[model samples]
Target: MTSSVRGAQLARLLGQWHALPGRHRRPDYAALAAAVRGLLSDGRLPLGVRLPAERELAEALGISRTTVSAAYRALRETAHLTSRRGAGSWTTLPQGHRVATSGLWAAGDDGDVIDLGVAASPAPDELIGAARAAADDLPRYLGSAGYHPTGLVELREAVADDYTARGVATSAEQILITAGTQQALDLVLRLSVPAGAPVLVESPTYPNALAALSARRARISTHGLDAATGWDGELLLGALRQGRPRVAYVIPEFQNPTGHLMDAALRERLVATAHTAGTELIVDESFVDLSLDGAEMPPPVAVFDRHSRVVSIGGMSKAYWGGLRIGWVRASAPLVQRLAAIRVGVDMASPVLEQLVAVRLLAQAPQIVAARRAQLRGRRDALLGALRDHLPEWTVTVPAGGVMLWAELDGPISSALSRAAEDVGVRLAPGPRFGLDGTLERFLRLPFALDEETLTEAVKRIASVRYDLDRGARPTWRAPAVIA
Candidate 1:
């Protein structure tokens, strides 16, 4: 079945479509087509969905119907749209214009390539033991159908206990196990965010969450973050009051890419501000357990929530291992039930064995986390030292915790540097992938999850790439053969 976006919704997504920075002005229709194409390429607009009628969209955008018609025609010529006599126009990718990987998921690590694209660590030493214990514990559930939509009772209890330990009182009934944090975010988006509604996010936030918001057809409003200061309380609160978005998704605990840990005071004020603004807050705590500096962590954001508006998501992927693929949502029991019900239609339930392994892992979390933090600290320092020695001009604020550091290049050459590094067997996730539109072109997120030698070598390779690019080395690529 095909879904359609209405006129006003499409118009909201096409905000200032005709405004192009750093390029010569084009015709209104060409500008319009380019904007839509960019959205598709950025994964903000899902393919195969019907667009609004030209007349309706023209009226919504307050443009001429002829302009909309010409834009649609241009899109069709570019193979970005398809239409039939009865069916309306739907979005598609032009042949050979398939989007580059966003590096939000796992990619094959076969070869000598040093992949700083993904921010996941290898499985810890404790994981194999945990898996063995889980296997031993799995046979008891074999007699059943093995479907636990809400999650296994023991794992739920463990997750709830963790929240309580973090100062948020929770119960087993309040937890819904997801395959990972991404799925937890997806389920919440489906349940809470309606199409055409406004959702607020940080400017350089997680790319996957932006993808999810766009997939839901929600109007994304962005708030900027500071590298030195992290969040501006007054500015963010003002945005909440002005936009009145339906939801605000924040990664307060060692936020992704930026790695700014929200202080307890800021967390309290943020929660109160969202409560006053009547926006449901989705706080991601995936990196909370990876504190490398032995600092006291702030309480979970849900602890400060007076109203039932805050939803907390955590997972073992960041702190433990990505292979386990266990994540959960902490909310009111009623909301948990609602999310579980919606989740059943998606994947039925998370695997039983993984949940069992997650339970054992949580039981060994103290020891596992201690060892992991020590290992990550050494790697992080090694990368930092390497950057300082080889690429001294780049500005990188040491992250308190998290797998990656966001470094600002001296110039807006991050994209070029990433392309050049590919030739030297170093894969990078460029800075723009973490932000809206084409912003953040001057920054790069470098992950230190690899071993010390690998991280140091990757930095050296990246420095060499930068040096060549600074000296006017241009990269060339051959066209990929299309598979017909």
Candidate 2:
């Protein structure tokens, strides 16, 4: 596209009455910097594409011209973008770098014990074979320069079609590939919530999501999670009804750590509540396809919404393999356009080669699911049984789908236990990380991502540790005396 036409398109995009957002009005320098980095990473803006002039962009985005000028200066300083005579400002690639080599979140050392840290199980031999086959198809991608921003078209259509097959019918136009669900969630948050706005997430949910939200300085209100009763429809429904948060974030299908499914009816109602309140619902189904025991799961929340009120996030990291690092968002065409705009500023696009691999996986879905299903089932049983056998007093909910068991210890020793477990080479996620307060101290998130032997060894290691410190010898509640 020529600069004039591109500029005109940009004008129309900005002309659409500015929803630049209330919280975004003040202009956060760090966020703007991160956004600039994201855009350059993705090729949507491309190297050497002239940025809209400061004054013009300020008017277009309906923000102060000072903010735009400051943001441009910030990007220029970082070398993410530069300005020169006779040319407007332009975005440039980060100098000689690997995109995934660095980021806010990172994996722990491989030597760590029972790294229940990652929610993904190791790839089975079958997937390896499939990936090998996928590699064989790579020569085809060579026809192009491999800079696919919206992901390979085949993968986009296939991802959309998979949901369609599940009765939630989606079209390829609604899809955009990402590095993983993490990136998908990040981008969704970037587009949906302005800095310092409220974004609702479940209590006792994944810590990384909280980290992402925190990094954005978003106001977080967590709905209650009763591990005893599984997921309470009334609690969530009440929270949504009352809080009226800007977004409702949930992992309805076998939620991480919690291993509970939001009631199906509530899924529909939740979507309705979001739309009624003008908030968006981001249903993270990263673990949806990894169900154990053949227990059926309702289609994604996106399936129940006609509009784009609910955006379903998925990735190959959890279900198929973590190394895939490819996830996607399914939304209405308009939202995709908005998300693409945000994405263009964030990372540009997911790796083109990975998208190809994902398309190949989608092609072989039937055989792959059958084999993965059996493996996950075995791991689930083993992990559950080990938890029961060792921590006999602890409660491990019967997870209908997904890896990771949300185990509540009968006693509170997680602080000492986590430290001890690390000594045993087994690094477990302390439950407190999942909640804002120390409420999850009596709980532990054990991912069944490891094989039986590893799970067994981890259980044994924990059982041997003694958390009986003199500070507080026995399990005790911290509540003050109730006035009956």
Candidate 3:
């Protein structure tokens, strides 16, 4: 038996069911069953969510109990719902359904397997030196309880100073340390947006962010971000005016996967728009430091925030080593305090040694950034060249800065291609993982964080897989859309 939802809750989740297309042409029970199927297929109704009892749901929807029973029976026939005598019905994917996984792909134990799924780089040698320095400096905190829920004072000040240098004046009091940008995003979304309230996001935004928002059950509103033109300002502004979402999450600088940087003028306009609509803006600047063009980057969007409506999240995972696991949230002091209090209920505090190492790493930002840019530039060039030489049919945009290339395939078969690649010891994240409604199937995010030899081999394997797929080879099994 799956977890059950109350009749009122199920009714709320099925908002505007009657407005679905073709309702007038079908019977009441069939239309209702079709609506449920659409919700399950599109991920609006998550797997294992027990539906309301027939009589209770009938009362809530103002329908006869027989209609509700018939609808449930219809769903049972389709295998979208399963129920036991005592246990109520729950939603599920039909057998043989192929959907994109909602999170990062896991690496298999095979050493020869190439993981193009995750965009992460190896730690620099400086990490060892910083760890040693942090170990030497760890004695100072030994006298205390060592559980600083907010963060170490020195690390907070360092983060503030870094932001200050970037033209956003920040203070230690306004910063809350998190495990990483993922946790920072999770905390901000949970604390700021109410369940069922509208929340705006970029359509082809980060996958993990979508997962976080979906987990919160926030009413998501999306505006498209073109790979060529970056964000559509008019579309976003219109959504702000009409949707009036409680929170707007954006990756303004060096956006993930797309690698398009949001201009400073557009940033100001977005901040102004969000402010006018009374919606708080959450700016994720995790990719800000990875610019490969050597051009002067714009200041954070928080610089344009006068109404305290912008909350910025910065992290070390992209620019520096992900092993440090240090990220921070910059907001008003009161909001910082609230997030910190919430943090206590989660993990209490981040690792003190990691905080200390992050403090040292902050002081070495210049050197670390230079080295990262050089390595990433080389890898990016190599991958682009290999793709041009091997898979010329795929169109790719060279991101000015960032770890991945968003490539458009010849057809909407990214899921099928990924499944085929897995058979050849290559893993990929299909395009639908980054969008709603199972869209963007023609795109794939290819990471350039690996060595040239590894990347070349991976692309060669992918090409081979594509060949097999084109020749009518079928995948034996399907990857689950939601991984454990």
Candidate 4:
């Protein structure tokens, strides 16, 4: 790629590097430094990968080498890197380069390279003011023990109200707030799923959900979503009905990575199928609000949960901000009570500050929605255009809305593609990250939450890296599991 082309691409990618927690500060220099620190801390950028030369990386990031050098120097002085004359500076692990890894909360991480791992975006600028003002409204809970096991009444009420706003009839008694959606899902699975019981999930579902269920030793089964035709609602419903699964967890709204939204009719029928099969429908609506193209809203799975068989999980992570550490579960009152009992034994409750912030943030829902939609829109267009230009051999389906995107690599270059990305300065979530059986080997998920310029650069780098990977040697890729 030419410098001008790379520079333009880098500009698009780096533009989306908004000021995140401990990442970007006011001055671009400070921001890049903190970003480097974040990469190292996140382990997306490992200590020693022999980063791309200063000029290449600089062009890829659309910045001057001086800034990159200063950032590297700062990290090196902090023992985050080691440099020797004639040899490029190699980032060193914090405690021991051999094994010890820095925690994500640590201050220095930018020294490492390749950070295509995080699937998050910075909070809207409006959140800071909202959060500051919301603190003043928190005095009422200060006198109490601050041990809200189910969550603050206001936040729970807000969540229920939001459900109602989404065309679902919900009440505060039906809701319980935890520390974001992950915990909420964890709580429900912990309380409901039994050992060795059949757990049905969409193939290429969120990986963490599989982990949680697996830790419980559940007999996990999958209903594969066809990329060519999107999802097969009838087949999935048939499987659920025929097998009578114990639990069916799904991301119906803008389903993760694939970004395919299940139609409303499908959701209704699936809910009925679960009810008939005596299965609990665990519906995750985490990405419901990420409509990048102003597309029609996909109805929440909870909307069809009238039979009381559906359990709902919503969070502030994907929809709002990940750092908030707040999410909630809406189910029957009895089920909520059960999870609450299970939760106290796990971790008391989500922090009061976060709950307070969530409540405050809920008040500005319109603003958050608008900002997120706008950012995603720009990111989607940029990524689509870049892929079309540079990686013409690859295949990409522009999703209507979602933080992450599911794309095919023309061929089964999933593993090779990942290695190629690592060769440059990108760490991508492989298609297998979305599934357990490794059927997603031909696919890749990219989060467009980054800026347009950064998205372009990331794609260009991946393309260049792929070309490099294909040249001399052909590595045997993992054989994706054959669909039965």
At residue 417, give the lDDT of candidate 1.
69
lDDT of 2 by residue, 178-255 (tens): 888999999888888888888888888877788788778888998878886666777777777787888878888888
Residue-level lDDT tens digits of model 1 in 281-354: 99998899999998999888898988899998889998898888899999999999999999999999999999
Task: Estimate TM-scores for all models.
Answer: 0.81, 0.73, 0.81, 0.76
Of 2 and 3, which scores higher on lDDT?
3
Residue 342 in candidate 2, Cα distance off native in Å: 1.9
Error of 4 at 128 (Å): 1.3
Query: On a 0 to 1 TM-score scale, where does candidate 3 land against the true structure?
Result: 0.81
Highest lDDT against the true fold, candidate: 1
Question: Model 3: number of clashes?
Answer: 0
Query: Which wins on TM-score, candidate 1 or candidate 4?
Result: 1
CA lDDT for candidate 2:
0.69
Worst 10 residues of 1 by lDDT: 101-110
- Flag the better candidate by TM-score, 3 or 4: 3
Of the candidates numbered 1 and 4, which has the greater lDDT value? 1
Listed per candidate, the RMSD to the true structure in angstroms reads 5.7, 15.8, 7.1, 14.7
lDDT at residue 370 of model 4 (Cα atoms)? 89
Model 3 agreement with the true structure over 1-484: per-residue lDDT tens digits: 4567777766765555564334455678986786566445334457888888899999988889999999999888767789889877888655645333321122332466687878889998799999999999999999988899889989999999988998988999999999999999999988987788799999798988988988899989898989777898888889998888999999978787788888888898999999999999999988888989888898789999999999999899999988788999999999999999889999999999999999988899999999999999999999999899889999987899989999999876666577567667787887766776566768899989999999998999988888775565523433434434
Model 4 bad stretches (over 4 Å):
1-114, 473-484
lDDT of 4 at 367: 83
Clashing pairs in 1: none
